[model samples]
Target: MPIQQKDPSRASTYSWPGVLAIALGALSLVVTEFLPVGLLPGICRDLGVAEGTAGLAVTATAILGFIAAPVTAIAIGRADRKRVLLGLTALLIISSVLSWKAESFATLLIARVILGIGVGGFWAISITAAAKLVPPEKVHAASSIVFAGISIGSVIAVPAGSYIGAHADWRDGFMGASVLAVVCFALQLVFLPSLKMKHGVNVRDFFGLLKDPKVRAIFLTVIFIVAGQYAGYTFVTPYLEQITHLSTAIVSVLLFAYGVATVVGNFVGGAFAGRNLHNTVVATVWIFVLSLASIAAFATSPMFAGLSLLVWAVSWGMAPVGTQLWLYNATLHAPEAAQAMNTSVFQLSIGLGSLAGGIAVNHAGLHSSMWLGALILALAVMMVYIVGRMNRQPAVAA
Candidate 1:
């Protein structure tokens, strides 16, 4: 069944406060999701686990998030969205506290699983709701703000956690996340509107998206680009140390620069994608592929490596919004379902990319991961072209 069309005159007015709160919530959720990435070594030592085992703290959230997203979307059908978002934020707070108090790896993994539920659900709603929180003209800006939270999370939160955990204790990172979550939760409770469901997604709507070849193509583009990006990026620091001989401080500065570029890329992406999603994705993927290839082929010098990393960050950072908009436009009726599936695939791609990178690092060498990433991303570019050709049918609203 198609979604009913809305009268253009009844469009929402911009609500900066509501949108800002959602962006903050998005930032907090991403920070909580990846908080352990920066503290893996510390977690291993404190919990008496191997580094590989401690890595599960990050994996647990992603795997469960992949499962939780679609389920939460379907289960919470027709429920008040504001209440659901608030409940998810509360879950984040509890998960953070539990992470702080966890004594064993099992305990910590349990907390991450809980956090995954919130992360998945929060993402599922936040992106789809952005259009609702503002006038149609400002939807792109609102969506960009929400995704900027992701870039900022990648840029600041993880590094801050590492610094805090090193200065104090690993648990301190969790404590900080808990405090931030509390603040975000309170703000949402006070300011977020009562966003009741206009239409509920059913099992059919969820499955219906896969029936579209274009949607499948979009998902494939996401998987290949994201997985390839992470495959190389997971071991980037090691590559910098081994290949470029960069010191820890230089590496930190380079990473910080990369983060900043990503934020810039987010806004640029919004503009580009808003004007032309196909061209934005096509251009971004090539930039991503070329950057990785540059690092693989010519990163013998620190300057070259740093420059490649910066370009990669900007291209990849611009990706989420462009990709989200592509999927939303591609499946107008099933936007939530599209977003949910995209979220799940995004999480899965991270895990896949990391796993692939780990294997490459073990068998080939650290530098080899860059080559692997480039190869997969080239395939992604091809996928994008193929999808473009197949999208001759006009997009239909659900």
Candidate 2:
């Protein structure tokens, strides 16, 4: 049986399959991007580098993605998006293959840089592309499906890689990811329809979107939200070990449980955003703040710490979908640019949050990082409310 093609012009009916294909792409990109985190120790040992130095493999990908997201969106101006997406996924395949065979830190870093290009490009386009495939009312739902990939990747793929590295050779993790990337690439090639770039964002236009008060507000909210998240999350394992007094095995299990909780939160957030975008977003930020406060105040007991982390995972997981909905609705005409800027902000927030946590850990204490994160989340909550009220654009859903 042949798959019936729908006219792109009349994309009034939702395309769940197409939305799902994009979601899978999101899954593959995230899994590949973060895969090295789990294997860093093995990489250091195998390549004769210190743990701190092997950490560059992760930094390299983020730095490149921070630069590449908007650049790729602009460079591929008016190109057929399906082809662009396919080409980007092909880069992932190549990068993964190179990663598997990497003989030195330099080789692995090179592969990571290549993977960054794919990550940046795929994320820049995926949100808007998914929106185009679905009905207007279902856009948030579609975006959630796509962002759910991020949660799933964090929860499942990275840990799975860590597990594989623990049991077998670390290099096997890269090979396994490479195989997964190939399958995802094939799916995009088969399912994504021909989509030409509409009003590709250049430097001038990109800045113009920022000039819009609503867009600016949304970006500011993201900085605080994500920075707060990473500030605490980046050092969570250490906090667990030192403060919660959990063994390494217990910490690993707890982290895995957090990941599962995050996926559930992703969909829950999406559904709420679909119903009440502003309220849902505001609520999520407050929950995040409370979760951080819990850790900061009462992580002395393992059970208390574990429960706090579970709340943190689920609350933070809602953020991507909620924020993406705000962006898509606020920047109705320039979805690509909005998403690109969001992706760039996301990368920067990770760096900022991690740096903040590092400073806190060095000067104050591990628990201080959680306090800092709570403060940031409090600010984000304020901003989310202000922005939610200010942006009176007709709601995507009543």
Candidate 3:
């Protein structure tokens, strides 16, 4: 069925409720995506698989999510975004239910594969949908609201899932996720307006976006920053356990601190980006470099390690908001396509970071990963600086 367009005049009015619904949807999807991270041990024991084998569940989602983002943008083809979102939420519901009942490793992996599709499509459209829900001037705030869900979900998922798995069954965590998705879907049904696309996006649009040097720079910066972050973060627990000599309990508390810092940074970053996009991006990248260096430098001091971790978390929290806003501003003509590309790069870079960090740890030791990450982010700082210079120049007449 063709998506019917709502009255064009409605576009002028803000839909704060609708934006909130999308935020909830984001929360649901993210929780579902990462729940496995905390429940992996239980899953491995139950399914008679090794830890590395169980880890494939996460790898599957990331790899599929990377593919799904751009493909989803092309596949939707001018469809009503409201329905597309609804369908994706429904997919989440199905995936979560399947996961809740999954008894075999194969069954659980299959469920996660379904989830990857939902994750990709939802993220690809969410920012654009959130932007459209309000007036142009409030786009930054709306995007921030959506990003808040991600930050909160990341904080909530592991601990919550772990708690549930410890107290009950790991599958119960997925059941809770399903319940969340169901609520999100219902809220979206009640709140989301018809969101017809202005034009259908195609593969060519993604390629055309790559031709812009600014866009390429933005993506390169994303890769460097995100991959670097993961490289260090992927092994942070070990570093704390061995080098810092913190107990598991203390490490958990510090991680919670990092989570809280991340949430605060998201809003702070959004507010700053709203005021001045270019400067915000530059400042955040620089802060990211410094924070990573601090963590590595103070590896032997628990107080300093914890402090640097919070700072690092804050800088990372700010990063997505700043880079995303930069991408949106640079690709106003095709924001969705650009966002889809951003999503792909972000997912791929996570895998890259983890792999690189793993290699660095295996060879050079735990501290090496953090230093490598900082070095990678230095490149990102340079890219952001060059991009800032490009933006400052006057446009030549075509």
Top-TM-score structure, candidate number: 1
Of models 2 and 3, which has the larger TM-score?
A: 3
Q: Pairing residues by index, what is the TM-score of model 3?
A: 0.82
**Candidate 1 versus the native: TM-score?**
0.85
Q: Root-mean-square deviation of each candidate, in angstroms?
A: 4.6, 5.0, 4.6
Which ranges in model 2 have alpha carbons more than 4 Å from their true place?
A: 1-20, 40-56, 103-106, 130-145, 190-194, 238-243, 271-279, 358-372, 388-398
Go through the candidates in order and give the clash count of each. Answer: 3, 0, 0
Provide the lDDT at 136 for model 3: 68
Best by lDDT: 3
Q: Write the per-residue lDDT of candidate 1 for residues 87-153, one digit (tens) a residue.
A: 9999999999999999999999999989988888888778766667777788779887887776678
* Residue 105 Cα positional deviation in candidate 2, in Å, after optimal superposition: 4.0
Tens digits of per-residue lDDT, candidate 3, 180-224, equal: 999999999999988877776799899999999888988999999
Better of 1 and 3 by TM-score: 1
Per residue, candidate 2 scores C-alpha lDDT tens digits across 1-398 of: 99977544323545678778888878887887766656654676799975445545656677677778899988988787778888988998999999999998899989988988888888888887788787677887987788777667788754665566567787898898889888888787777777764456788768979888888888889989988987777566557767888765676677788889888888899799889887898889989999999988898988788899999999988887788777877788766677788888787676576567667766787778789999988999999988877766445445
